[model samples]
Target: MRAFHVTFEPFSGGCGCGRRGAAVRGADGRTDALRLRAAATAHVACQVTKPNGSTHTRMGIKKLIIFLLVLSLCLEGGSAKEKGTKKGKKKGKQVYCPSQLSSEDLARVPANSTSNILNRLLISYDPRIRPNFKGIPVEDRVNIFINSFGSIQETTMDYRVNIFLRQRWNDPRLKLPQDFKSDSLTVDPKMFKCLWKPDLFFANEKSANFHDVTQENILLFIFRNGDVLISMRLSITLSCPLDLTLFPMDTQRCKMQLESFGYTTDDLQFMWQTGDPVQMDAIALPQFDIRQEDIDYGNCTKYYEGTGYYTCVEVIFTLRRQVGFYMMGVYAPTLLIVVLSWLSFWINPDASAARVPLV
Candidate 1:
């Protein structure tokens, strides 16, 4: 069945009808606004869903960053603690000065090490002051040679060795003098001791009574700490008793035997009164000056038998300290004299009367 359609005709500018139309238009506009509002609501729901998804990811990243920060702090704290602990512990290595070494400590060094110490401590021998046996006069040449040879060859004589302790009272705080005198160091016998071996006699074919006058076969030791020790052995051949003979003749028999035969000890002892000791610094043998005189037996005998030999052995052990002084006393003056002579040549010959005289 077809329903009857109601159709409204437009009235001409009438108030009631126009107002109804206006209201209808207004209603349509309101419907459009509602649709727009629905669309905006849907967009807002999609935006909220996306933001929720991203919120979890952002929160997880923040937690990871915080954890890393805490872990770094813990590791840093542990490293700092380890460093502090290390610094608190003591180190194992140590250093020592020469003065720090006590007597006991010095004793621990081997003999070879002690020798090295002495080599470093002592001064070397001077070449200029070396004894010139050849320069001796012709008259004294034979005696000098005999004395030298006897000193080197003889094994025994008045064998005496001494060890002296030298100590100076200078202020340690003050600088040492330019010309420091070693003699200024006092000799303290109580600080050192010595050992000696005596000479013995025997008979030989060349000599009626032979005796050793010098301890040539002896070995002397001077430690770096100034201790001295000596070892000596002697032998001689003599038909007669050496004790009965006169001064020079008695020494000849001893000299011949000492030059010919001897035995020596390999080791020696050096002790100190200070009770504390170090190694030997230097060693030197004593020197001897010997003189000989020919004696005539009253009988007219042409042979050497009737012509007895008189020999004298003068042993002088100018201690090592004294030897150094002797060298200095001789060489220092000579060097000064040479320097003065050279300077004199540089002086103007016309400058002064002294210059002319010197020239």
Candidate 2:
């Protein structure tokens, strides 16, 4: 028998001839190539299909993962944006409206302790009573400039206020009794008196704008008899210094300082009725004596008076305005007599002689 052809062919799924082959044994102990080739072809086809399928699956999974990551980032960003918008609205609301303090709240503040030094108090005429004069006349308004100097001494603060008055005048309403009049009016300085109400008393921190200072309540009063007085009641809250004993020990110095404030009203014009119309008169300053006192410094229940603590300065200043007289002598009558004599000299001599003879 012809030797059983035993041949094995190297499988090339592509059609080709002269391909290298390998020998295989048949089931009947003979070489069989067909079955072997068929099996190899099937294995190659399965391997190719498996790899392609696995590649497609992996790419799909990757795309799904990237999409999920992008969506999660977008959600987080949107949440942060919403939170920021809420915060902005809250700040905007607070900017337009602010809380206010009630009148009862202001009443809770304590009064200054310096209210009692001089017992004789002179108050200004109530503005309500003088409704016509509710606003100060521009000519009568006094411009005062006050400068304060202070030093810290043992247990007290030594402070002084320098005062200067400009264009000072007495109220035109002051009148003298008929019995007090003299041929030459001798206006005594001691007979006049005055009092000034400081502007600090009516300050309300809540209603007042933080930067405003023009809303101060201040007044000046004068007596017919030359005496000047000042009354100031101020309530102030302060933070105590670290060293309390460095305050000044002398109370008199403090009083002097409080009285040192001065004013400028020189340009002020005084008005008087001249028979028919108002006329402007130059106002003269009065000479007066000044006395100062610091009555109470709040409550001594906690500490000694004039200590380095939050307290007020109640000051009383007694002052006087002096008045002098202007003498109008017989000059006007003398001039008239001289004028008549000159006219008589100019008269015709004959006419004058005839008139004299008839008399």
Candidate 3:
């Protein structure tokens, strides 16, 4: 859904022009850029253009260009700035809001999801979370270049993963009319009360920095059958563990795990949106080939005080490091250098450079 935003900036008093009471200023705060430009345009049109009749046309063209450039730049910068702020402010407490339901009706609702209405987290759109494998930027085949052989080639990837948590459990208070007998109605999740949210986090994150694509419940689709579905998208960057002990000829297995925080296995369950419960996407690296994709699911049970078993899903990506890249960049160069060093051996035995053996 598209959002419409409109803000009005008031302009007050003029310019360096001798015209009295012709200046403009912001009513509340410092002057706005557009307002200042507008004031300047007005000053030019009123003071300068009035004297020279032919100059009005030229000045008008200049004023229009200035206005266009200023408006375009301001809009673009403002949008980018607003998006950055939104993505940054994602860490915070959650406040649940529900549709208007009476106190008596609320008392009738159950505290948790029953067996009949088990909520499922559906991948509404194709998820794009942490595309690389084994701490390598391998999402795109083009990024899998043999730049410096042994040196790690870096590439950036931004993933947008959207998931929907939907469950059907309706209320009589929010019933619809005959004409509005549609299966669902969409509303802001914050406005809808008594919704259950899973405790989700990226478990194998090695970096402190990440970009949150969005920070809102976004949308809540409530169906007539009492099904409540919440859809939201989140973005995060991760560097998987890489051994590199074998260098280019080595195989790597990286993991991305997701587990329930407070809720134990008894309270909640997690599964893949499709195929195997531990399903994952294939790596996009060209030089590094993927051997196999694996999934591990188990309960983390602790015998400590007030601890319970929690279920977790660990997605494993097995990658085989391409040797050709390393051979060209590292091994080949070293071999060449070593062969060239042999030339020093051909020098006179008396020379100090011949003392060292390149082989």
Instruction: Compare the candidates by lDDT and give the number of the best one.
Output: 3
Q: Pick the candidate with the highest TM-score.
A: 3
Q: After superposition, how far is residue 317 of candidate 3 from its true place, in Å?
A: 1.9
For model 2, residues 83-138, the per-residue Cα lDDT tens digits are 79998987544311001234454345443311110111212223122112334521
**Candidate 3 residues 1-359, lDDT tens each?**
22222223333322234444135555554554455555555554444444324344666767766765776687668768877888777754464232233445545656443311211211111122221213332110000111111212333211112223222322332333334445666665444344444555556544333223454535566565444455443333445556767766877665555666765555555554443333234444566775333333343333335776665655555567788878898999999987887787578878775556543
Which model is ahead, 1 or 3, in terms of TM-score?
3
Off by over 4 Å in 1: 1-200, 203-322, 356-359
Score each candidate by Cα lDDT: 0.31, 0.31, 0.46
Q: What is the TM-score of each candidate against the true structure?
A: 0.16, 0.16, 0.44
Candidate order (TM-score)? 3, 2, 1
Candidate 1 lDDT, tens digit per residue, 1-359?
22222122344532222212222113323423323333333333332333324333566656655655665566667768877777765432243333334667656666455332432232232212212223421111001112122232333333222222122111122222333333122222221122112222222223332233442233444432233333333232222223423322223323221110121111111112232221222333333232233211111111134433222122122211233444566768888778877877787767787675544
Clashes of 1: 21
In terms of lDDT, model 1 sits at 0.31
